[model samples]
Target: SILKKGGIVPVFEPTKATAATLALELPLPSEDGVWTVLYPASAKAANTLEDGLCSRGFVVRRLNTYDTVPATWDTATLTSAQSTDIVTFASPSAVKVWSSRLGTLTPVACIGETSASAAKRIGFDLVRYPDLPGMDGWVNAILEVIESSSSSSLCKHNFKA
Candidate 1:
């Protein structure tokens, strides 16, 4: 609907889902001012979709979107409790905000490469990103981490290090 009225959608190119959606939705190149619906943005895509669209040659008639706001965390209470086993971050913004409050979270599972990079840059040790790049993949990666941790305890008694 947005494309019909001259709006652009900048999707992440690294994910297969975005490519498939673009193939189905975007129109063929023509002289009609390049009425393309999908513009694949790499890891360094603009902060906002409207900015991404304009950067990629789409004329945004209106821009009414906002970035994700960071939520306040009760760090004092959390610091007294046990360390988190696994922390999942779906976006770079979440990683930024969460890491700033809580120094580092081990066994971190990020939804994509971009989020994983942010978490790692903030000193997260066990950050993992799925190869498939989706919600299911991210969940599976988290499950894998849990399973590995569970099994490691069984051999803790026999470990020399």
Candidate 2:
């Protein structure tokens, strides 16, 4: 049991039924330092991830990504994109408090095909989505949209000089 103040919380073997939340099984917790960068602008849920890492005795660093796109591959490289008119969230957690931020403008995009499933579960009516999921997949998708937009812009500019 883990003692906190005057209370005791029993710790169960991770192999137990609570294991349902486990995203993976083979790779166990690491003793090495673990720093996680959370993107898509959800802070409260980030703490849960941080705490989990700390429970494993891992030094964790938390970084927030709230740039142009709702999410990205490189957490550090995730800067604001001025050209972003459409935004996507990686998962439902990213949208945990998104209702307050969804204003009258700006279209919404969702990460991966599975994100659609998440959105449906959360009842998000308007959300654009990517064909694939995860960072690499989402990055490729946003890159595609950027390239298309840039090319379209060039065509419209038609610079002679």
Candidate 3:
């Protein structure tokens, strides 16, 4: 098995559209057996992306991963912190994980509102999210924050520090 060959196979995290990504990724590679994937999307994600998957001959299912909000990322929180002023959920799956762990209402800053509202029934809220699509915006927001914080002495040479 690939697991035996490579140890535990890890899937990338913080995917906004886990199901979508799986639906796209699964068929590309050869898979076998009764395989299932968890897709955590807002109502819109659940509703809109279905036909596309069906077109590809996949049976995508939605799971209640209990992700309420997309993670608004603060580097400090990478180790210790109960919360943040703003968090970013780059993926819909990230939102689900945040929702499940934090139960929404955490004032998440996300890439878009659709992702924000995915967990709306669970009472999550969006603080300030980006409109530009994909990962570049997410990286920029984090960089902007890193630059603004006076106490953060992050240099190119000392990135880990």
TM-score of each: 0.57, 0.31, 0.36
Candidate 1 per-residue lDDT over residues 1-161, each given as its tens digit? 34445876644343333333333443335556655344434343344554544555555454333547766557666674235566788877888777776667456888866678778888888787787655778887777666655655424434221
lDDT of 3: 0.51
lDDT of each: 0.61, 0.46, 0.51
Model 1: residues >4 Å from true position, as ranges? Answer: 1-32, 36-64, 75-82, 147-161
Question: What's the lDDT for residue 104 in model 2?
Answer: 20
Q: For residue 127, what is the lDDT in candidate 2? A: 52
lDDT of 2 by residue, 5-53 (tens): 5596634234321112222221444546553433233343335445554
Worst 10-residue lDDT window for candidate 2 reads: 17-26
Give the per-residue lDDT of model 3 (tens digit) for 1-114: 355478876553334434455445544333654444345655534544454565565565865455344556676764453434345665567777666655665445556555
